[model samples]
Target: MSIDAIIMGIAFICIHLFANDLLPSGRIQRLKWFSFSGGLAVSYVFVYVLPTLHKEQITVKKYSDYLTMESELYFVGLIGLLIFYGIQKVVRKAQKEGENKKARTLFWMQILFFGLYNALVSYTVISHEVLGIQAVFYGLAVGMHFTAVAHDLWREYEDIYNRVGRYVLAAGILMGWIFGVNVSLPPVTETIIFAFISGAMILNVLKYELPPDEEAHFPTFAIGVISYTSITMSLKFFFQW
Candidate 1:
């Protein structure tokens, strides 16, 4: 990685680590800003990431004769969503079961899943060839998404999250960045990883951010969705990506 990319990667990690603390607890839960951020993230995933994944899927199909299905990328994404959903279900069940064997097992499950998620995100951010204005936009969307993720973690784990979970996430990001800077995965492998992350992003935003229980501000969320989607679509059209 270039020095510029490495600096940007560190900056992104810092934003992910600290952005949640910048908002007050009540605002983090109830603010329209969170809705706007959620909208921005979800829109970016649908508008930019999914299309790129589709293109990658075509390329992967063209190169690899061993593949039997054309929709392998989408299936990989489905697996990602299902895996995370299963983890979430287990954790919720454990939480309801109180301080028992299942709860402890599921608590660690949540921690491990999110740690790996953060590491995957960090690795993708550093290793992807996104640059210039596109990189900035991608970083902004992901940073907002990270803010939502951090808030969810804090709400779910309370003092445990404050004491230890945040540090684990930060370490995950750093470790992922270190690996991304030093090593590179093959093209097909990278494509599969990106597809999986895209699916997880879709699941995370829809499940956590857009739920009816969330105090989402519709006007702000609509504004964010329309604005970011318009910008990204325009860029894609102009650049013919």
Candidate 2:
């Protein structure tokens, strides 16, 4: 792995481990301006991630014999979204049930899925296809994603998150980097993984960004989305990254 990839992996681990500290708490947590982070993350999805997924589609087209449908990758994305959405539903239900065993079951299920997602995203970041600075920026986009996710899990099951969830996710960061460095999968497989991860990311960003009606700040969110979109667009045009 390059130094940048190593740096990113370690940073990601720290994000999982220390997200509650990194983010604001109590009343500040519910404020609308906080949605700015979600806005920045959503901006990346539209401008950078979706286009990258389009490019990955070509690779999937070139290599696959059976999965030849033009929209198959997109279907994978949809599947990813649905999978995480189901997890969220389960978490919500478990919370309402207020049963220790059921919630514990859901918590394990949640972390396992998120752990795999974390690993795959980290794995993709260090791919040869993403290059140096691009990898760093991609890592940053995913890092914002990780921050939101980590905070959400931390909030939902604070004790379990502190005890087990963060460690599993932290290991996922290391696992992804290890796999990325040691193993090289076919381009098509990597593309599919990226697509799924992107879809899940979309749901997570929207989930956190939309919050409740009383908490969401449209003007603040819009400003974040517009400004970041402009910045990313400018960078893409100027640098072709």
**Considering every candidate listed, which one attains the maximal TM-score?**
2
- In candidate 1, stretches whose alpha carbon ends up further than 4 angstroms from where it belongs are 24-30, 211-214
Q: How high is each candidate's TM-score?
A: 0.91, 0.92
Candidate 1, poorest ten consecutive residues by summed lDDT: 209-218
The lDDT, on a scale of 0 to 1, for candidate 1 is 0.79
Decoy 2 TM-score against native: 0.92
Please give the RMSD of candidate 1 to the true structure.
2.1
Model 2: clashing residue pairs?
none
Q: Write the per-residue lDDT of candidate 1 for residues 79-98, one digit (tens) a residue.
A: 99999988888788777868
Off by over 4 Å in 2: 29-33, 128-133
